[model samples]
Target chain A: MAYIKLDREKCKGCMLCISVCPKGQLKEDKGLNKKGIRPVRFLDKDCSGCAFCAIICPDCCIEVYK
Target chain B: MKKIFGRTRSLRGVDTHYCQGCGHGVVHRLIAEVIDELNIREITIGVTPVGCAVVAYDYWDFDCVESAHGRGLAVATAIKRLQPDKIVFTYQGDGDLAAIGTAETIHAANRGENLTVVFINNTVYGMTGGQMAPTTLIGQKTATSPLGRNEKTEGYPLRISELLAQLQGVYSVERSSTDSVQGILKTKNAIKAAFKNQMENKGFSLVEVLSACPTYWVLSPVESLDWIKNTMSKVFPPGRIK
Candidate 1:
């Protein structure tokens, strides 16, 4: 099993991670974060453990585990 | 589950002030990761430039010095010489390295300063509100070049990696980008190589990273990355130059 945790407060909502995720597990959340930006949420589906999203996250908000 | 990725200890547990989708944050993380992996955080010193990443020291947990605009290499050279056992590096932007500090960078490389230089070439001066930098592509529009950069007037984009590679004192030179997953990985590896070269007593290593400036470019973060891939890479191709 693969899992990724996101620090929503640190997320800038750039969505770069969403674009790079091979598993399409991330999506933009409708709720605003502390910074008043829409944060991304993981779909909690079958993650491939590629870690592409974590790698591309400029804010360093994501941590990946496999 | 095994932890595959997390923030490195070399970086402070604080969020960076970089704008949304900025490449500086990604580059910072990569450097921090490299420092942790190499176990050199305690002996590493970073020189921060006067551009967008001017306050890079605030995010990095290691010792850092602030340099005057474009004088990053000069300060870094002094630091490396005085403390030969330390791993010194300069994090400079396109405007700081290729324009105001060009002479310092060239002289440092020519003298083989035995330091690492992480050059962020984002085409425009991102911090000062999108001014045309020395690396700005021809026909690209910036605040200073509102009418678009003309070849006859602007001359051409300065390819710093290629120019520095020509110096005999330079040990290694590589150009990488932050446009894609592979490109980001390559950039991290290039940074690691530069740091390793310094540790191995190899003289002057420069890794020029073609980064994105979404706010300055008047494009979305993703679009700016695409521009770097499809447009900027054509002029500053990613690869080893020396």
Candidate 2:
């Protein structure tokens, strides 16, 4: 069940992490993050446990439970 | 349970020839891990440059070729274009990449050749008696710059990643460091991405790894890591440059 997360406060919601997910499991939640950018939302159920989502993330805002 | 030692038989245990606190070993291991994980041991061809990583052929157990200082990328480009079926990658140091091979690196990237560049930027030239490298930071002391690199005279350090990323032919370009555990892991992933992109026929890929040079930099291994973490990160930051 170990997968991924984007801390709401830390997530800049740049959409880069969502765009780079090889599995297309991440989505944008037009809702604002702490900085008011569209926060990156995750489809935890579809996560393949691949860390590409975490690696391409520029801000190091990704946390993979695995 | 974690696997012990290297995952690729391509890298036989010869006890690395690299000096302590040198990032070459870690970089080498990252390449090995990628080759093993991708199951491309026989297909991978590595081109070594004339620097600390020159003897990479001796350690990495794959098809290897040695090239002159700063000419590794040129050599790898030729090999890759001729043998596009093979996975071609060049392992180069800062002196080999930024200084002597500037034209080769820029043109190769501009051409979008299907090859991978594993650039180890240690700031100062390590093999050539610690000479001032193109990436040497201002106010940083080297053998050639006893009074530190005077930006007024020597000019500022060249940011290779930022420059290379601007080229249209490049498939991807990124920078990572080996100073910390997480950073080192990220460095491996970056190199893996470069190689993977090449395998997927994406075009030219370059992964600039900010490494520590204890012998050349005249700093203790621990101090060098600290310097890489605090000093180098300030200028390059981390993650994708492209």
Candidate 3:
């Protein structure tokens, strides 16, 4: 199974990853991090490992592995 | 199964100071990825600008020299001239490159300096609170231009890529955006090409990247990307200008 990890603290909660993920594998977290920003979370296990989120992320907060 | 994506060692283990959806962070990762792929971490040097990314040296894990506002090219020129073997590049913004450092940039390009320049064109002075920049589009409202930029007073958005391409000293000049997945990949390729051109001693090369400023643009992070794609791209089309 492919796995995508998001570094929550490093994320600026931009949601750019959510918009770019073709599989819709990521979603915004309801709770805020220490920075008081709503970080994103991996939504499902059906990840394509496309690395699109990693690429488009402005904060370098996502990691995709297979 | 193989690892597809992760952080590059060329970048430090620290969060960037850029705002959410800021293009500097994305570009920083691309540069770090390129440095890792090229195996030039040991011999690469980056010159920092005085804008939003002024502290870029702190994020990048390579030797970085801080340059005065708009003097990135000048500093990179000196560094490259002295350490002819090192891969020298400059990370600059529109305000630093197109405004304050225009003379230095033009002269460095004309001199055929062997170095790479990653110019982030967000169309406004981001760090200084969204003041109008040399690349700000017409009718674009900025901190200084509250009613939007007037052609009669502000003239037109400066097309640095096209102007630099006309220089005989420049070997490569490309304009790319970071609005979409395809655009980001293209931008990475363009950045890699710029660095590769410098490595081959192919004279001056620059990649003008049309990035987003969501906070200053008064738009959401996602909306900024759309602006880059639909609005920004029209004024500054993405492609190999040279």
DockQ numbers for every candidate? 0.91, 0.02, 0.86
lDDT by residue for model 1 (B1-242), tens:
99999988988879888889999999999999999999999999999999889899999999999999999999998888889999999999999999999999999999999999999999999888999988989999999999999989888999988999999999999999999999999999999999999999988999999898899899999998999999999999999999
Better of 1 and 2 by lDDT: 1
Model 3: colliding residue pairs: none
Local accuracy of candidate 2 as per-residue lDDT tens digits, B169-235: 9889999997766787898889888888988999999999998888888876567778988998898
Measured over the true interface residues after superposition, the C-alpha RMSD of each candidate is 0.6, 13.5, 1.0
Docking class of 3: high
Candidate 3 per-residue lDDT over residues A1-66, each given as its tens digit? 888888888878889999988898899999999999889989866898889999999887777788
Q: Sort by DockQ, best first: what order?
A: 1, 3, 2
Ten-residue segment with the worst summed lDDT in candidate 2 chain B? B1-10
Candidate 3's DockQ is: 0.86
Please provide TM-scores, in order, for all candidate models, with all chains considered together: 0.99, 0.77, 0.98
- For candidate 2, the docking band is incorrect
Q: Weakest 10 consecutive residues, lDDT, candidate 3 chain B?
A: B11-20
